[model samples]
Structures are given as C-alpha cells and as structure tokens.
Target: MNIGFSAKTKAFYDLDEKAVYIQNASWSEDVKSISEVLWLNHCGQPPKGKIRGADEHGMPCWIDAPEPTEQERIAEAVNIRNAMLMTADTEIRQLKIIEEICALTSEETQRLMSWKKYLADVYRIEPGNVSSIRWPDVPV
Candidate 1:
C-alpha cells in the first residue's frame, strides 16, 4: 500500500487489488470511529454525482460534481461583483468622511477606489459596466 496526500484529501492505494481509498482530511482524522468505507476501483465507472480524475496509482479517482452551467455561473459572478462593489462604495464613503477631520493613509482611503477596474479585469467586462450605486466620485 502506498499513501499520498492532496490539499483537502488523502489517498491510499493497493495496486495488487486494483483499489484505492480516499478520505477528506477532517474525516481521516477520526477514521477509527467511522463505520462506512470509502473505496473505489480502477475499472469501475464514477458513481452518480462524481466525475473522474487521476488517483495515486495513476488510475481513476471519483471526484465531486462539476460546476454549474454557463448562465448560472455568469449570474453568480454578477451577484458577487455587485455585492463587492456595494461594500467598497460604502467603505469609500466612510473613509472620505473620516478623512475630513483627520489625516488618513492613502492605502486605507484608496483600497476600494480601484475595485471597479479590478472586477472588470477579473470578469473580463468593460470598466464602464461596474456602475456604482451612488459613488459619483469613484468613476467606472
């Protein structure tokens, strides 16, 4: 038996039996108390919700389900981007008001100022697409 590790999971393979065992890090830590077995074989197909990837023995490993559809993915990205923009705008406004009474570091005051550009770069959208809720000073 050979053992291998990944960021979130660990794997054990028995080449002679053509089988592999995998467990998440949290589950593996308390494996002695678990009654269920996590086993997979080289020749068997990936079960219902899983997809396949290379295992420790260079054989197949059943992995979690794939990502959502393109439309769902785009919608999720837009939602997250909107939330981030809102939060950034709020912070920028608060920082601007606080700066009027006392000196503030440019880092703190400008942290969210370029958020639109960043989101544009990350999402491959034009910067103009990230319209602010009410932050007229922070142009797209």
Candidate 2:
C-alpha cells in the first residue's frame, strides 16, 4: 500500500539544545522529498562529542560522523528516484484504468490495450494497467 499522509504531529531533535521536540505535521504526497529529508536527519552518525548538541549556528550537527561513501550516496539517489517513479506510475495507472473503463468503442479499447501491453513488455513497468507485467528476455 502507498504511504498516505499522517495527521499526527511529528517529533524531532532540537540540535541546538540537544533535546527532543515536536512540531505540527502536514500531509505530503511527495515520498521522495519526505524520504530525502528524513535521511538527512537520521542517516549519519552523531557528531564527535560526549554530549549531543547543535553547532554554533544552533543547527543539528553531524560533526563526528564519517562522510557518506559513494555507494551510500548512489543508493540514496536511486531510492529517491524510485519514489518519484512510483508516484508517476500511480498517476499513469489511474489514467489508463479510467481510459480502459470508459472506452466507448472497440477500436479505442484495443488501442489502449496495445499501449498497455507495450509498456508492460518493454519497460517491465505496467503502471497497474494490466494483470501482469512481462519482463524483457535480455537485460539492458
């Protein structure tokens, strides 16, 4: 199931005070954006210090954590991209479903079905337009 918006408030660390706090939360359909922000907040190890605290600027600091490796950055990028692709896929699927159900003529239905089949076979991406997807025999 898709991650829908949550109405509850969210808690976060106050980097400057080194304290936990809560804020009013809002809904978002942008999964990538949410994930990226969350990664920024939680991915890294704590900065070098016995006590957790914010930087001079009162922003949360990650001074002690090691730099992110190339693989980590690449994985994060891929995850973000997938989230966006999933959102687009949902939209496309909805459109195709509506088109399929509302088609007034056999020709139109056939055309839509052909397009759906092409997407399924070639892209390994069905957009939920059909019952199943057929992956290519040869990998790209």
Candidate 3:
C-alpha cells in the first residue's frame, strides 16, 4: 500500500506532528515502489531517543522488526501475483456459472457441464482471444 493510502502509515505519521506528508500511495502490484517507500519512511524517521536495544551492538534499533530483505519482498510479490491470478480465475468460474444459470433447465447439472465445455473452447488463458481457450482443460 502506498504511504498515502496506508492506514498504518497514517497512524505512524500521526504520532509525530513534525513528520512530513510523504506520498499518496502505491499500486499493490508494484512491489519495488512499496518497498522503497517503506524503507525511506522507516530508516529516515530520525531515531527517537538514544535508547539501547537488547542487541549487544545496538545503540538504537529503528524497529524490533527487521527490514524486509529484497528476496523476501519479491517472494511476497510472487504470492500476491499468484493470488490475483487465482482471484481472476475464480471470477471466470463464476461467470461460467452465471451463463449456465441463464440457461436454466430441468437438466441443470447437465447443461452446466455442457456450457463449461463450450467455455473451455473459447477462453484463452493468456487473453489473446476469449474464444481460444482449449477444450481439454475446461470443466465437463
């Protein structure tokens, strides 16, 4: 979430009146943008009081939380991307169900199976063509 749109960020800045209003937000899809904004926000917040942390070398620790490493962040992004795809897939499945609903029949189950086959033939996974989805993967 962009700092502008972050609920947590608003709370963070609200704690200090002197904190500058930074940015409005970031797209959920843009991992780098989110990470950069987060890093700048945390590391740049001038360390509060000179209090030693539990770590032996600690003069001050900005967070009990460690910075999210680049790979860890990318992994999170990967999960987000995967979930988005699954969400899209779920919507497509629902649309297929709706189409089947419109053709309500005594043989509702059979008609649904038939419509699913038709959908497989038409829906392209990569979106070059809606009518290009292969038949084998479509539900029966």
Candidate 4:
C-alpha cells in the first residue's frame, strides 16, 4: 500500500488502497483524498512504551505512551496473577476429575504436581515484581 500523510488532517492514509491507514479516530474513509496526501516513509513497529504518531513536520514518528503509575502497575500485576491462578485452578480441577475416574499415569501425576507448584509460585509473586516474573512451563 502506498502510505501518505495529510498535513491538513494530520493523518496517514493508504493512497492506493483508498483508506485511512492511521491517525484520528474520528476520520472517515470519505475524508481521504489522493491530491492532499503527502507521501510518508515505510513505518515499522514502534519502540517499547511508544506509539506511532506524526512529528511537527507531519512525518511518521514514534511517540511515548502515557506511563502507568505505580498503583496502576501494581493493580495490573495483581490482575495478571489472579488470572493465572484461576487458569491453574481450572487445570488442576480437570486433572483431579480425571484422576477420580481412573488411575493417573506417572506423567499425569507429574503434571498435577507441576500445576500445584505453579499455583504456589503464583501466590508467592509480588505485585511490584510481576514484570520480571519467570513463569513455569505448562505441562503437556
């Protein structure tokens, strides 16, 4: 697709595709115009904690996303940990049900033990340190 930027609208467009490639959420396909488009360089993925934006010159650029506050980070970590714990709980319950129906093989026993250990690890995780967590592998 031929990418172009509109200085008037401060938005990017797919000139050949006749669509808004990126920019304001309010912009519509009907608002696009090939004549008003300024060609832009090929853009790749934005850097970590950054997003795609236009510079003062209306060129494609990377801009920083709003940084999460410490409280927000902690809350996010807690949510992640809770979700992980819930998944582990479901897995364990399913395995236990299978165990009740028939004797589990050694591999199944190891998986059950691994899930238990993973649950423990989830409980031990500190919300502040969740970004660096080394998650255990899920048993096959």
Candidate maximizing lDDT: 4
Each model's RMSD to truth, in Å? 12.2, 15.6, 16.2, 6.4
Q: Write the per-residue lDDT of candidate 3 for residues 1-140, one digit (tens) a residue.
A: 23322222222222222234324432222112224354354434545543222223311234444556766755655554455455446655766677667854556556555545444443333333223323233343
- The 10 consecutive residues of candidate 1 with the worst lDDT sum are 27-36
Q: Can you give the lDDT of residue 73 in candidate 2?
A: 56
For model 4, the local distance difference test gives 0.70
TM-score of 2: 0.30
Model 2 per-residue lDDT tens digits across residues 1-140: 11111212222323333222123333222212223354366445544543233444333334454465766755655554455455445645765777778854666556555545544445544334332433333211
- 61, model 3: CA deviation in Å? 9.7
lDDT of 1 by residue, 1-140 (tens): 32232323333333333332333223232112111143435235668888655454443357787776766655765776566666656666776777788877877545545644544444444234444322223333
RMSD of 1: 12.2
Clashing pairs in 4: none
Candidate 1 wrongly placed segments (more than 4 Å)? 1-66, 106-140
- Per-residue lDDT tens digits of candidate 4, residues 72-119? 888988898899999899989989999999989999999999899999
TM-scores for every candidate against the unseen true structure: 0.34, 0.30, 0.30, 0.56
Instruction: List candidate 4 segments past 4 Å from native.
Output: 1-48, 52-54, 57-60, 129-140
Candidate 1, residue 132: how far the Cα is off, in Å: 22
lDDT of 2 at 114: 55
